[model samples]
Target: MNYWLVKSEPFKYSWDDFVNQGVGTWDGVRNYQARNNLTAMKLDDLVLFYHSNEGMEVVGIAKVVKEAYPDPTIEDPRWVVVDLTAVEKLPKAVTLKSIKSDERLQDVSLIRQSRLSVQQLKKEEFDVIISKAYEN
Candidate 1:
């Protein structure tokens, strides 16, 4: 399955809010690249939910429950969204600082394109982040 990371400001839509809602429609993407990433997602693809802005950390895991569909929140036909369900909260939230400090993650999309709301991850990169979260 493909791995991806999606960012949302905690104050706007935190991990708790996602778990409470059960399933969320990941929408409001306007960028061409980010929109394309959303369109590339497939059912059951794993996603890392990151709290951008304030926290700047990876907080939880989610999986695509539905593939790309016309974004209901906007009139623009170019935008689309996917349905995601919370898989689990990470054992520990992996901070951006931690990721940046790791030599293995230097080339990660999170670092290469910090401003992108949606990013893809290599399987090895995804595994490293997961390992970090579970570390003592």
Candidate 2:
């Protein structure tokens, strides 16, 4: 399965909001590259939920429950969204500071393209972040 990172400002959509909703649709992507990443997602693909702006950390894991479909929140046909369900909250948040400081994640898309809200992650990078979250 593909690994991905998706970001949202906690004030706009927090992990608690996601879990409370039970199922969430990933939408509002207007950027070409981020839109492509959304389309690339497949059912059951794992995703890291990052709190951008306020927290700047990976807070939870989610899984794609449905493939890409036209976004319901907008009238624009060019945009699409995927249904995701919260899998689990991380034992601890994996902060941007930690990720940037780690040599293993230096080449990750997250670091290289900080402005991209949705980005692909290599399997190793995904594992490393998970490890970091669980680290004491």
Candidate 3:
């Protein structure tokens, strides 16, 4: 299964909102690269829920409930979205600062492309972050 990271500001759409909704179509992605990432998603893929901007941390995990589909919110055929359901929140959030400092996470797309809202994650990178989040 492919791993991914999707970012949202807490005020715009927080992890709690996602949990409350049960499942949601991840939308509003305007950038071409981010849209391409969404198109790459597949059913049952795992996603990391990140609170960008204000929070700057990876807060929860989610699963792709549906594959890429035309984003219903717009008429643009170039845009698409994927359905995702909240799996669980991390015991401890892995902060951006911490990720930037970690040798294992140095090559993560999150640091290499700081402004990317949706991006791919290597399994090792994903595993390392999961390990860090579970660290006591």
Candidate achieving the largest TM-score: 1
The TM-score obtained by model 2 is 0.98
| Tens digits of per-residue lDDT for model 1, 1-136 | 9999999999999999999999999999999999999999999999999999999999999999999999999888999999999999999999999999999999988999999999999999999999999999
Encode model 2's per-residue lDDT on 64-113: one tens digit a residue: 99999999999989999999999999999999999999999999887999
Q: Local distance difference test, per candidate?
A: 0.97, 0.95, 0.94
Error of 3 at 25 (Å): 0.9
Any residue pairs clashing in model 3, and if so which? none
Tens-place lDDT digits, model 3, residues 38-101: 9999899999999999889999999999999999999999999999999999999999999999
The positional error of residue 12 in candidate 1, measured at the CA in angstroms, is 0.3
| Model with the higher TM-score, candidate 1 or 2 | 1
Indicate the residue-level lDDT of 117 in model 3: 93
TM-score of each: 0.98, 0.98, 0.98
lDDT of 1: 0.97
Model 3 misplaced stretches (Cα beyond 4 Å): none
In model 2, residue pairs whose N, Cα or C atoms come closer than 3 Å (at least 3 residues apart or on different chains), thus clashing, are: none
Better of 2 and 3 by lDDT: 2
